[model samples]
Target: MSNNTNKILTALAAGIAIGGILGILFAPDKGENTRKKIADNSKKLSDSILDTVKEGKNKISGLKHNLRDRAESLKESVEEFAS
Candidate 1:
């Protein structure tokens, strides 16, 4: 079962690699320009992904801080009520 799964994964990877190679080969730009475009595209994609992750982290952190503040306020209210 594991062997079959590995074979499938390998085949899928090979197919993707081949498709990418063919796409690059048939692309309209000159080789140098094509390389540059690919590099630029890769950088942009990486930057976008990084920025998205950072934004998500900031959102999560803000939520955490807000929750903590609410919890503290609730605790204080309960304490005052019991006094």
Candidate 2:
């Protein structure tokens, strides 16, 4: 994860949280209902975040393997040329 990726994810998470909070706060619902909504929204938010992070991790891992393979190929080419 690069700095920009981290910043973007943080910003996204913050935006989601603030939006959820404001939406719940202004809704015309009883306390019990509001609390239940909050719980459900939080659960959804957490799952969403987890999914995003996992996706990023998989992408980064794939990139790392590709780079490693390319580096090895380049190294073999250079060795063959030098020999």
Candidate 3:
């Protein structure tokens, strides 16, 4: 996704998560329980997001390497044909 789209989605997610947490805190549930739930959910969300970003970076790196190899091979073939 584009940087702008990522920023928008991130803002939306933060808004939603914060709103949900506020709702839970104001509900009849115990404060400690509500806080624990929020903490756990936030941790899980962060971990999942981090993992996704790492995977994307790895994929991009692999593509770069493959493209570079292909370019080099093409260069060699052209040089051979020129000789």
Candidate 4:
């Protein structure tokens, strides 16, 4: 993974955690309710991160294929021109 991607992911996680904690703190609720909310938010954050990772993997794979194709095409052209 790139440095920028790492930074973005880290920032996103921090933001979500801070926002969730603040929201919970301000809301008038029982301890059990607060815990449940925290659990639910954690699960959602986990799922979101997984989805983002999968998407980045897919995009990288696509770029790899695209670059490979271009390289192969250039090689073929060079061979044809030399012959």
Candidate 5:
């Protein structure tokens, strides 16, 4: 699940970066303005990526806790059955 999430996030980031670059290239703005726009867009993209990573981390942590609990429950059930 983590791997799948990472793949999705990576694809999303790639798409955003590609779209931003294309937009910047096609814009008719002056050099300085274009550079600034690119910088701003890059910053925004970075922030979005960071947020996605944080969210993924939280989800993974929750999954880990749930799996641990399930494993504990299974272990207890096995021990009772064997007694």
Candidate 6:
């Protein structure tokens, strides 16, 4: 993924975390309920971010392998031509 895409994802994750916390804090629920809600939301948010990062890491790894393959092919062609 592009840097812009990574930045956007990071921002989105941060926004979700901040928004969820603020909403829970301002809610009129009991302390135990509020804590539970916070824990659930935090777990959800962390899972989402972890998934996205893993996806991005896989994409980048694939791209790296592809580029290496292409570069090796080009090098072989150049060596054949120079011989």
Q: How well does each candidate superpose onto the true structure, as a TM-score? A: 0.64, 0.92, 0.72, 0.88, 0.82, 0.77
lDDT string for model 6 (1-83, tens) is 78898789989999989999999999999999999999999999899899889988998999999999999999999999999
Which candidate wins on TM-score?
2
Candidate 5 residue spans exceeding 4 A from truth = 1-8
Candidate 4 at residue 68, lDDT? 100
Model 2 scores worst on lDDT over the 10 consecutive residues at 16-25
State which candidate, 2 or 3, has the greater TM-score: 2
Model 5, span 1-83: residue lDDT tens:
56887798899899989899889979898989988998999999999899878887888899999999999999999999999
Worst 10 residues of 1 by lDDT: 1-10
The sequence of per-residue lDDT tens digits that candidate 4 reaches over residues 41-81 is 88888889889988988999999999999999999999999
Worst 10-residue lDDT window, candidate 3: 1-10
Instruction: Evaluate residue 74 in candidate 6 and report its C-alpha lDDT on the 0 to 100 scale.
Output: 100
| Residue-wise C-alpha lDDT for candidate 1, range 1-83, written one tens digit per residue | 24775577557655655665567768887999878766766566556655765776688799999999999999999999999
Off by over 4 Å in 1: 1-26
- Which residue pairs overlap in candidate 6's backbone? none
lDDT of 3: 0.81
Alpha-carbon local distance difference test for all models:
0.71, 0.94, 0.81, 0.90, 0.90, 0.94
How do the candidates rank by TM-score, highest first?
2, 4, 5, 6, 3, 1
lDDT string for model 2 (10-69, tens) is 899989988997899799999999999989998999899999999999999999999999
Name the 10 consecutive residues with the lowest summed lDDT in model 6.
1-10
lDDT of 6: 0.94
